[model samples]
Target: NLQLLTELDFAMAKGKLSLDMKAAAPALNSEGRIVLHQARHPLIKKEDVVPIDFELGINYHSLVITGPNTGGKTVTLKTCGLLTLMAMAGLHIPARSPSEVAFFDLVLADIGDEQSIEQSLSTFSSHMKEIIAITELAGPGSLVLLDELGAGTDPSEGAALAIAILNFLNQTGAYTVATTHYSELKGYAMNTEGVENASCEFDIESLQPTYKLLIGVPGVSHAFSIAQKLGLSQDIIADARQLISEESARFEQLITAIESSQKEIDDKKSEADKLQRELQEMRRTLEQEKEKIAKEKQELLAGAEAQAAEIVNKTRRQMEEIIESLEEKRAEQRLGHRLESELRGQISEVEKELSAHRHKRSTDQQPGEIEIGERYEAIDLNIEGVAKSLPDAKGQLVLEAGQISFSVAADRLRPVGKKPKAAGRRPRAGQAAGRTAASLTTERKMHATTELMLRGMRADEAIAAIDHFLDDAVLNGISPVRLIHGKGTGVLRQVTQDYLMRDSRVDSFRMGVEGEGGDGVTVAKLKL
Candidate 1:
């Protein structure tokens, strides 16, 4: 347990260091490929290290890297091999996320000098011994790193031997990365399948390495250019350039042109990536704004509905007070038949308005038009009745339910089965059937005068008298009824019109026109 704790402490310390270095956990790829994104060597200072992007073992099994010396080609080779070993050993690699490392049974490398003076083996001979061992041991599960393959020998023979060795490794299915300065090797990679060329960039003006790895572009040695920049005579440089064949010079020129084009392509790709990110951000912002607007719209609607409800409730309470006052007058036997009829109409209208505000009717089934003399059901009151009159301008119609006639809104009633047939016999001309004393009294009330005199009455008394008169006028279908309230101080006329305005049965009221009693009277139009 103590040993296990010690190992835990060591792991925690390593994790902290990884966080400080911004290292990412490496992903294992099963397709025999390694992809390193912005990978830097851990031993190198972070600011000084030039991160490299490298990939292999998928499109190509072998990579032949060519570049000028001290241009980071060797460092790239070492970085790939070391990172692979680190990932396989379960250590976080100094690379960005999405870095994938392939699992290899053996990580083989033949980098740097291998000369052995004690064994009497020259540089070329020593490298041959190492190459022979690699050829024997490397297989499909090996990650081989061969730096400066076929150096310290004749250029033509060495280039041929390098190509042959690379072909053998490809046959073995080993993932190989090698560095060389031979132009023949670059040509071989271009023509051969499953082989790719890569290079490190160098700045000729500064005589410094940029250390930027560019895949699919062969490297240039810059031998003549470097010598001239270092103060070598122009004649000597020209003489040296002439030693090379025209084919070789043209091949080098082609590589230089390709490098420039690759740089431009990389710049365009970066710009495209930046634009894509900005568009994505804009889309997200627009979506959020849309959601906010929808939410605010719903809130506004809810507030308006609440305000309307409060107004309805307030109006309901006022109407209830008016009904209570009429009821009190009726219980005291102070209301005549006309006033009693007005009270019932007022109660019916108020109840219907209140019921509509209280409940929302379903829209699934619609109520058909209510025709006169048709049997229908009052949905709110839950009572069946027969329509006695067609709807008025306000959609209110008279309904006779259980021998009691009352006004109801047309929307509250639904037709019941078929309309009833007219069965009652018509009275003879100038005569009526079952005429009685009560009927005669009703006829006299219906024929009441279209004018009411409130000239000498108080405001309260005139209000009550005008209410009764309007009710009778509406029952008798008399519109533009006149009220003689007089122009004395304008108090009576003001009160009269005010009462008319409040009464639902009164459509409108105004001071009488010329020859119609002028300002001394009020003319009210009742809702028939």
Candidate 2:
């Protein structure tokens, strides 16, 4: 499952990454790294895409783009190389073209001059080594980029070495782009069929490079313009221009024309400024309105929520009041039921004792109070009776007990304040004398037994109770009975079990595992 989720996440990220890359149009081999009207600085924060056009290799192995210093010569090199790398890495490139590349195995770039002090290699030596590495590794399928090539060393030695490296790479059929200030390399591009030359634009009147790229024209350094910008005297600039040959001077004149055109372009830029300002104002107005609406909506929601909370609070209070009233009524009802049960029990006991007393009075009375054909109670409280009539219709005393006419079941009647008449009749054969007092005492003794009372138990307490019950069962013969403590928090089970351990009376006991009573019941086995 973890592997499956990881794959799904990777697939999602890949698709998203692909979409972002596709959205950034880049110039590649299929569309030609030659961007027509490309507008982006090679190393500028927030690069603006400049509308300039150029081509690399429609039929050329190398395009040597050059222009005046501080123009876009190095920038052009970086833009092309960086975009190519970006594309190959499956990242979006800032370009406007149908850019694509057959996955190149290597993209070798030697752009800026970065000294390697740690490696103890000079600037020129480092560059030469990097160049050597690129040439050895580059093949027909590889892309190679070089910037300001052969500029770190002496011009004569550097130019010769640069030419040799270019020739070696060109022989390998490796695609390469190199930037150089050496006029010798421009001549090499002109002579070599596969090599091309391009230049970044420069202005003449104000003496500034347009920082724009142009193809089909190699460029020269604007030495005089830069010298003047750096506060050099006019005499020095004139002397420098005179030192150059007539052909170089004429090339300088042509560069002046391009510079004049750049002024005209700058003048025409006002319209773009006006459009940008208008867009900014509209965006500000929209944002202000959005903020106002958002704040109002938030306040309204807060108010509604407050009202809702108030209502809930009020309802809660009312519910509490109703619950309190119900509890009070339930308590009163429970108390009333208890009082009524207690009263009933007291009345029943009193009536039983009164019945027993009246029966004893009648049995112990003299003969005058219990004459023949008179009514009387029985001696035994369990037997309540009254005398009806004598047997043989002779008006003799006939005793009536509960559910039985008990001349037999009832006690004999006695008169008040007189000796009992005992010689009235003799006993029949096989009839024993009346029950003895000692025998009655023995019967009462036989009926006596033990009872149990328990309350408020935890689980261990319950187990102990069971153990004690086992003891009681063996001692008192109490069986097939019930425990009367009401169901409550099941602490009883824990306490009961704790107490049951090592208890001498317990044989075996367990929480009834199933219908035997679940957590609520325990069953015990006793040695008895």
Candidate 3:
């Protein structure tokens, strides 16, 4: 119970810390590298601390930081060590996301002067003692932090010792971060492989450290510049600079020039990033506008269709009323065949107009080549027929359905055949024979029987015969035809009635009564 309560309390504390300090949990890996991005020391005040970017163990196993004194070099080293330890403890560190820490079996440090007067040890001796102990324990699974490495001794001897110590530790395969102001160490890092140079920036104008760590560049001590800024006499500063070697002065000037160029490049890159973000936002806005326009267009089209349908229905009703009135007058012997023929012509014209309207609204089907002699279905007319000719220059083709021919647009036809001969190709011998049979069948249809006989025939054969008979009756203007199926089990009669119900040419159908063959025959009325 105590352990559970402790874990709950720790979770709450971590959440609160993350909100207050802008801390993030680091990714842990076994890749033998530590990457700290914009990391701050946990003990430092959030507003005062300058975040530093530090990396080790990938490109270089050891880093030698060089800069002016009091320029946050030690702070950078401490932040890396502290964040690494915090990550190993499963605690969030004060850094941005994508910060990664490699696990280490040991964390060692030789920071600050540990002079012991009682033991008769000087500052340099004290530092060496601690460094010796670190060397003995550090290995590939260790993180070593050495601040002011090889300090508290003569400049030349200390630099040489620092270079030797760094080389030895690197050979041991341990990840190390050390700080120094020696120019020789900087040159060593530059010329050696698996060793990189880093610096904590110092602003001479402000006489303060920016504390921003820059990798892949060595730092300038800025001693003469800082002294001049701090009111030191020009003559004294000049004499101090004269004591330095000519090569060292030129090297420092080169470092200053490189730093200036790097700053300019960083500024341009930031501007480019801002422009990229703006372009992305504009693209998203344009996509939303396109979707909105499409939806509005669909709504307007639906409203227009509903209005068109209402107008067509009203016209059909008016035409029916006029036809009924004329029929009534004819029954009284007041009108002749002339008036009936004129009414039929008017009805055909209306049907043609209606079919054109439906074809215009059907925009989904794509236009395709109209192959000659191939069976196709007319989408608007709901009829299947053979294509008699290839599409003309205007994409119009002649289609024959039931004894009637129509010149329709290629877009109004959908092919229904498995294989169709190409346009402008001559028919093979077999296809020519098939065409001869079709012509003979058409001739037979001209003398079609007014009364159809379906007795003793299968259901499928009866339906096929009924379809062909109805087509002939419509073409010959025959009405009130008798379909004699001879009711027995009633299957043929039921099938006959069902087929007639779905045929558009069949205006009406009914079973005969009494003298008209009773229930044994079905009388059909076809549209003239």
Q: Among these predicted structures, which one has the highest TM-score?
A: 3
- TM-score of candidate 3 relative to the true fold: 0.57
Per-residue lDDT for 83-108 in model 1, tens only?
99988877899998898999889889
2 or 3: which has the higher TM-score?
A: 3
Which residue ranges in model 3 land beyond 4 Å of their true spot? 270-481, 484-496, 499-528
**Per-residue CA lDDT of candidate 3, range 90-185, in tens?**
888999879899999999998888999999999999999999999999998888999989898999999999999999999999989999988899
| Residue 423 Cα positional deviation in candidate 1, in Å, after optimal superposition | 66
Which candidate model has the greater lDDT, 2 or 3?
A: 3
User: Among these predicted structures, which one has the highest lDDT?
Assistant: 1
How many clashes (backbone atoms < 3 Å, residues ≥3 apart in a chain or on different chains) does model 2 have? 29
Q: Model-by-model lDDT, in order?
A: 0.84, 0.62, 0.83
Of candidate 3, the 10-residue stretch with the lowest lDDT total is 329-338
Q: What is the lDDT of residue 244 in candidate 3?
A: 84
TM-score for all models, in order of appearance: 0.55, 0.44, 0.57
